[model samples]
Target: MHSTPWSSAHRLDPADQHLRDFLAPRHSPAGDGVELDVDTLLSQKYNGVVELRVQVAAFSFQNSPSSQNAPRLLLDSSTPLNGVLEALSGDATYAGCGRCSAELSTDANGIYSPCYPCLPLTGVRRYYRPGVLTVSGRGYSQLCVLAPPVPLQKILKAPPDKLHRSSAPGSQVKLIQVAAERLHALLSLPKKTFVITIRSHFLCDENSAPLSQDFTLLDLQLPTDCK
Candidate 1:
C-alpha cells in the first residue's frame, strides 16, 4: 500500500474536537493570495532533499501606508543541505534593528557575490509590530517553527477597508481555528521545509477597496543531519 504522506505518526487527528473547532470556519485572508499544495510540498524526512520557492522581488513586510513594493523570491534544489542561503546581492533597501551581515561564495555564478544571513525572528517580530513566531536559528540563520493562531484583535484591527468584505464578519473566529489547525499540522513534521504565507493590507482610499499584499516564509529548514 502507498505510505501516508510524511508518516502515520505525523498524521493529524482529523476527528479531534480541537481540530474541528479550528477548521470548521475557515476563510482566506485579504492580500495577494497564497496557495500551497500539501502533496506538492516535499518533506526531507523521506525524500532526502528540500526545495523552496520565494518571491524575492515581491516579498517583504509593508514599510509604509502607501508603499507598494513587494519582494518575493523562490529557491528550489534537490541537493541535501547544511544551510539555507540567499542572494542579498539584489537591489533592496536593507534596514533592521537587529544585527545582520552577508558573505560571498564561489559558484558557477562566479563567487555568487553577497549572501545575507537570515534575519532573527525577534527582529522580524519587532519589524512586523505585531504577530509572534517561535525563534530557532544560529547567528543569522533562523528557522520559523510555529506561528500561533492569528489573534482576534489582529483581524479586527487590520485596516477595515482592506479586509475581505466577506471575511470581516467572521475573520477572527475563522483565524483562531485555522491557526490552531495549522499548528497541529506543523507539529506533526520534524525534518522538513515549511512555508507560512502572510498577507497584509491597508485602505488606500475612502471609496477604494482594500489593497492586500503578501510576504513569504523563507526557508524554515533548520540545519539537520537526520534522514
Candidate 2:
C-alpha cells in the first residue's frame, strides 16, 4: 500500500485539505481542473485579479534600497545574529563578508580561523520581505508575492510599534533600532507552508512577466499559527 502524492499537500496544510482535494486534479498535468489561471484572467481583463490558494515556501527579508543593485538580506537561521544587530545599530548599508561582519571568535591565544573566500554572501539589508509561494491549483510555482504594510505585519505577526520595518529601514535608525529586532521576529515566525489569496498585475508595456506572475497577497496565515 502506498500513500498518495496529493496526501502530502493535504497534511502540509490540513486547514486547506478540502481546497487541495477540490483543486488537485486541476493542479496536476492531467488537467481535469477548470482553473482560471493568470493568463485566462488577464485575457478576460487586463491587470485582472486571479484568486489562488498557495503554499508559502520561503520567507525572505530583502534589503532592497533605491540602489538598483543593493544586496538583499535573505534573513534565515544562517544569518549572523550579532552582525545583524551591529549593522542595524549604525550603518545605513553594510558591505562585507560574513566572517568580517560577524563578531570575532578568538581562541585563548587570540587566534581565529577565517571563513575562506570571505565572500559577501550573507548581508544585513534594509527593506521588504517577499513571502514567495506556489499556488495549489495552477499555472506556476514560486509566485512573486507582494503585500501592503498592514497585511504584512499581520502575517509576519510583527508588533505595530514603530520598531517594525514595513518598508525601508529609514534614517530614524539613530533613535529606533527596530530593523534588527524586526528581522529577529520575522525569522522567528512560522514562515513555511501556508495559503493566501493573491491579486495579479502586469508590466506597464501591457503584459505580465512570462516566467513569474506578479502578485499582491491579499492575506496570508501560517499553518502553525492557525492551530
Candidate 3:
C-alpha cells in the first residue's frame, strides 16, 4: 500500500467499517495512473462543530513572490479573476489558445494544419490544450489567497467594550486580534494533539433580524512550532 502524509500504519476498528470504506481509494476516469484518493486524517462532527484534517497532495500558486526578498504586497496579482483563468487554463498561453482558435488536425496530405503543435508540447499540454502560436489577449494577471493566523492571547486581552460591540470596523479588528491570540495559545501547548472550541451564533438580516447561524470552522492556521 502507498503511504500518504496523512495515512497511518495502524489498523482501524472493525466497528468503523463505514469510515474505512469512505476513506478507501476511488478510481478516476482520468486514468489509473491518475487515480486520486482522499488524503484525510480525520473528519468528524460533534454538537454544532465539524472538524477535518487533510493533507495536500499537490498545490499551485498563480502568483508567487519573484524573489525571497520581494515585497509581500507586490506579490499579489493586479487582476485576480484573470489569475484564476490562467490557473484553470494552464497559464496565459494555453488560455489564449483556447480563446483565439480551434483544435488543429492533419490534412489528407498529412501536412500539419493550423501551425505545427507548439514545440515541446509536454507537461500541462498532455492534459490540456496549449496556447495559440501568437498572443490572444492582454492575458491573465496575478492573484493569491492569503490566510494568516491569530494568537489566542490577544483575544483574551482585548478591551471588554470592543468585544461587546455588535458591529464596527474597530470591533472587527479586535475580533481578529483575539482569534490570533487564541491560536497562538493553542500552539504553545505541549500536547501533540489539541481540540479547538468554536462557538456558533445566528446572523442578522438587513433589518438586524436573527438568522440561523450554524458556524463552521473553515480554516485554521497552526503555529510554526506545531507545523
Candidate 4:
C-alpha cells in the first residue's frame, strides 16, 4: 500500500473534527445541491462566482448581549477567516479598546518581542474594548497577528507593516465557538492560546449597547497549530 499526504497516518482529532464539519466545500456528493469540482474551477482558470455553505450562527437572546450570553462565532481555522468573515452573515467586526501596558513594536522577522498590542479596534463606539489575551511562560512574546488582514487596515493600523505577512502556518487555525453553557471555560482557554474576535449587531433585545461588553461574544479558540 502507498501512503499519501492525507493518508490515515494523519486524521483530525476530536477537537478538530467539528472544524471540518463547520466549513463545507462548494461541491459535495452527499447532497443534490450544486457542487463546484476541480474541473469547473480550472475551467474558469480560477476566477468566477463560487458558492459556499456558510455556518449560520444565531444566539438565543434573553437579556443583554454583554451578559455571559454574548454574541460570537468562529470560522474555519484562522487562515482565510478574514476573507470569509464578512460572508459569515454579513456581520460587522468590532475593534478592541483594551490598552497594552506600553507602546509595542515588531521586527522584519515577524516576531513581537517588546510590549504587546490589541486587536482590530475599529468601531463607532468608544470607552469600550474587546477581550484580553495573555501568554505565560519563563518568558513569552505577544504579537497581534492578522490573517491576510484587511490589507491597508491590517498593515497601516496593524501592529506593523510586516504583520499582515506574519501568519505563515498552514491555512488552518482552530476557531472557538463559546457555547453559553461552556462560557466559563473561556477563562482558562485550556492551552491558553486563542483569538477573541467579534461580530456586529449581535443584539438579543430591542435595546443596543454598542459600548457595552454585551455586544462582544467570547471567541475561545486554539492557536493556529492544531491538526
Candidate 5:
C-alpha cells in the first residue's frame, strides 16, 4: 500500500461534526490491529454552504517485516449531496419561513430560521417539503435536484432547455435518488478500486439545434480493511 497525505479546512455543522466523531479512531476497535483517524484541518460556512477539508489516516498495529508503515491513501470525498438534502428535508428549522417563504439557513447541526425580528416566536412548524439539491465535486458533474419526480421517459423526450427551465418542485429528485443509490451500491461491494463516470447532456441553445454534455469521473480507493 502507498501513503498519501491530504489536508483541507472548512466549517462543519453539528451533524457533520457528529459524523466526523463517529469516524474517529476512538469509536473503532483498536484491538483489531487496525486504527482509523479523521482530522479536520479547518471548517467554515461560506455562501450558504458548509465547506471543510479533512484528512483520513489509517494505521495498522500488526507487525510486518516487509513494511513498517501501513499503506495510506488520500481520497477526494464530498459529503453525499443526497444525504445533505434529505437531512434538510427532515429538519423543521431549515424549512422556508411561514410568513415570508424565505429559505432557512443550515449548518452542521441542522437548519435555523433567518435572523429577522418579524419572524414569529411560535408556530415554527416542521414540513416535509423537498427543496433544490445540487451536487458538484472535483471530478463529478454537477446535478440539481428535481421536484415532483419527473418521469425518466418524459425527461428524455423533453427538450434539454425545458428540463433546465422547469420550475416544477421535486423535478430533479428522482435523478439524485438514483445516483445516490447507485453510489451506495458500489461502495458496498468488496473492491479495492472503483471507477465510474456520470454524464449529463444539455441543450446548447434555446432553439435546441445542438446539444452539449458534461462528464464526471469518479475514482475511489476503498480502505484496506473495507476489502
Candidate 6:
C-alpha cells in the first residue's frame, strides 16, 4: 500500500466483502481491470448542510498522485445535479487532495490548535449536460454521471471550460458545495452509479506516461423516479 502523510485516517469499510475481494491483492493492472464493487454507502452533510450519499471504492489507479495529493483517496457521488450546480456556483471543497498548511491557533493553555490548513485545487472548470458533468483542471480531467434521475435522452449537455496549464502535475478536479435546501432533494434522487475520471499529473510508473484514468464506479442506490 502507498504511504500517506496522515498516519491514521479512516479506511474503507472492511465489512465490504466485494471491496475486500478486489483489493486483497495490492497490484495495479498495467492496462485495465474491474471488480464487483461492494462497499458501504456514505451520507454526510456539508457546510451548506446539503446531504450527500455516495458509494465509496478504493482502487489501484495508474497515475494517482503520490504524497502530494495526500490522504491518498478519491470519492464519487451520484450527484450530477448537485455536483454541477455546486461547480457552477462554486461551492465544493476538494477533500483528500492536498494537506492544509495553516497557522495554529492555541487556547489560553497554549495547547496546539486542532484545525489544520489545506490546499485547494486551482484552475479548474466544471459544466453539466443533462446527464453528465464534465470537469477540467490544470493537469486533470473528469466526467461525472448520475443515472435514472433524468434519462440521457432528455438531458442536454455542455462542455466544461477549457483548462489552462498549472504548476500541479494533474488536471485539477472541481469541488461542489451545495445549499442546505437542496440537500434533501439531492439525497432523495433515485440512486444510480457515480463515475469520476481522475487524471493525475504523475505518470503510471517510471515511464513518464500520464497517470489519468477512470477509477472505480460507485453506485449510490437512491429511491424515487428521476424526472
State the weakest 10-residue window (summed lDDT) of model 6.
Answer: 40-49
Candidate 5 TM-score, true structure as reference: 0.17
Candidate 3 segments whose C-alpha is farther than 4 A from its true place: 1-173, 192-227
lDDT of 4: 0.28
lDDT per residue as tens, model 4, 22-100: 7757643222223333233223323223222111121111221334465443332232423332322132222223343
Residue-level lDDT of model 5, residues 1-227, one tens digit each, is 99888988886675787878887776222122211111110111011112211111111112122343644221113435455334322221224455553445557787574638544442333222222223333333333322111221121223222322433566654433433333333223232232212222334557644454332212123233432
Report residue 141 deviation for candidate 5 (angstroms): 30
TM-score of 6: 0.19
> Of the pair 2 and 5, which is ahead by lDDT?
2
Which candidate number maximizes lDDT? 2
Off by over 4 Å in 6: 1-31, 39-87, 91-158, 162-188, 194-227
Q: What is the TM-score of each candidate against the true structure?
A: 0.18, 0.39, 0.17, 0.17, 0.17, 0.19
lDDT of each residue in 132-188, candidate 6, tens digit only: 223222223222333221222122111223222232457354222222113324333
lDDT of each: 0.29, 0.45, 0.29, 0.28, 0.31, 0.29
Where does the lowest 10-residue lDDT sum fall in candidate 5?
Answer: 37-46
Ranked by lDDT, the better of candidates 2 and 3 is 2
- The segments of candidate 2 whose C-alpha lies over 4 angstroms from its true place after superposition are 1-47, 75-140, 160-192, 203-213, 224-227
User: Which structure is stronger by lDDT: 4 or 6?
Assistant: 6
Clashes of each: 18, 0, 13, 9, 24, 17
Off by over 4 Å in 5: 1-112, 116-173, 192-227
lDDT of 2 by residue, 110-205 (tens): 654344556444432222233332333344434556664445556534333333343445554332344454444434434434445556655554
